[model samples]
Target: MTSRVRLGSLIAMLAVAASGCSTELPGSAIAAEPSATPAISDARSGEVFGDLKACDLLEPTTTPKGFAAPEIERYESDNGCAAQKRGYASVSIYLVPEAGIDQLSPGQGTKIPTKVGGREAVEIPGDSGTEACTVAIAVTPNARMTASTSLNEGTNEEACALARELAVAAEPKLPRVG
Candidate 1:
């Protein structure tokens, strides 16, 4: 067969084979089907913390060393607060509804499982060369509160420690999870 005809035939054969392929696991009789709705539990339904503000969860006394009182800010869909000490450190708190600890990405850093107020949490160390860290505390399967710290002169461990401290301070203010 000519090269063009052979290539056409090969492409057609591949298309036919691909169409018959199933994503089911080998030896599994049932093929998993995608759910029409997400598998979110009642605790994670984004309604438990309705109208709660992130800044309200953190008090001025909770500010880390070298940072000033937190300044409250409300975003379109989320609430947060930030505290900063010029040339030292900046700390922020964010309340994320419908987002869980599992959704927290470490990027180039690492996620260390931890707990805040006996609730599941993750401590994410800053990426290389950055003095920043985050602690995410799970409120439910779909909601979490994050405390992030960035320092001008400090190690990742220090940042992580501060972040965890902030998370701990704010955890008690959250609604109890089932």
Candidate 2:
């Protein structure tokens, strides 16, 4: 009798386990849709590296009455970042071309190469003219990710990172023209 009870219990347990493994669950019928678009695709962001190939240097807007606008330069990238000399500073913008984002960096502003060239070059503070800044939007590969960065003294490194995030979060992507 004891042996029979044990065997009965074992069989019941096996039956329950088997039932759980059966394909009766609705989840089993559902298939993954490859066509589903990702929320972070290149079209959603102002990325210049991927689907968005270029960005025009728009005029910098005015800052508040008391505060001044940092010098900014509108830059666009094709395959990679391009370098330019402005006074004592250098601005660069990098593009992934596939992802659609642009990465920006502004170096110390220096003087232009000239004939006499005896005048000393000056470094513009990060807070100078609006044209003194360089912005970049960077896009990663299949991720279609976009990001941006600005170089201003008031903008901390963390702030710059956030700016990049904001760039990635911008809008539909296009191509670089100018």
Candidate 3:
């Protein structure tokens, strides 16, 4: 598992605040380093990507049109995967057996139940009226796929919509074994 501090720092870096333009992590900002080889190797089970280190789950070749590929980066198993697209939206998809520290779409904004890939899901804004949103989808009884983002590239609704779309796109690629 990735250290809580590292995961926290990574997630923190993506957090959007009510202050705007000043997204700050809880601790010092940790620069993303080369992650060609992810820390957790056994987690590799995605039907499409095969492994997390490949970072192909959300690549341009895998995603739909208009949505550019992100430079997938991670700290370890704990950090999952994250990317802040240069021209597209900044997003993170944290696959978790349990929830811990997540700065993106922090807490529960406004809970709006919805469906993704024929599965029940919930969309929550980072905060009421904020330009950030998150979608939490259950992958199993003890696991979930959390897609989150801060709307630096679009409106609040768009961010939430993107989150849902990303989740739908990611569902098929997820590991069946997990």
Counted clashes in each candidate structure: 0, 40, 1
Report the C-alpha lDDT of model 1 over 1-178, residue by residue, as the tens digit: 6999999999999999999999776775777799765454645444767677777766543553546677886541357888888988877888877678898778668889998899999988884347999899898877888888888998999988888888887888888856
Give the TM-score of each candidate: 0.67, 0.24, 0.54
Clashing pairs in 1: none
Q: For model 3, how does the per-residue alpha-carbon lDDT over 59-88 read when each residue is reduced to its tens digit?
A: 542244444455555532353556665566
Name the regions of candidate 3 deviating beyond 4 angstroms.
Answer: 1-54, 61-79, 99-108, 127-129, 175-178
The lDDT of model 1 is 0.78
Worst 10 residues of 2 by lDDT: 57-66
Error of 2 at 75 (Å): 11
**lDDT (0 to 1) per candidate:** 0.78, 0.33, 0.59
Q: How many clashes show up in model 2?
A: 40
Q: Identify the runs in model 1 with alpha carbons over 4 angstroms from their true place.
A: 1-46, 62-66, 73-77, 127-129
Q: Pick the candidate with the highest lDDT.
A: 1
Off by over 4 Å in 2: 1-51, 56-94, 98-146, 155-158, 161-170, 174-178
Ranked by lDDT, top first: 1, 3, 2
- What TM-score, to 2 decimals, does candidate 2 have? 0.24
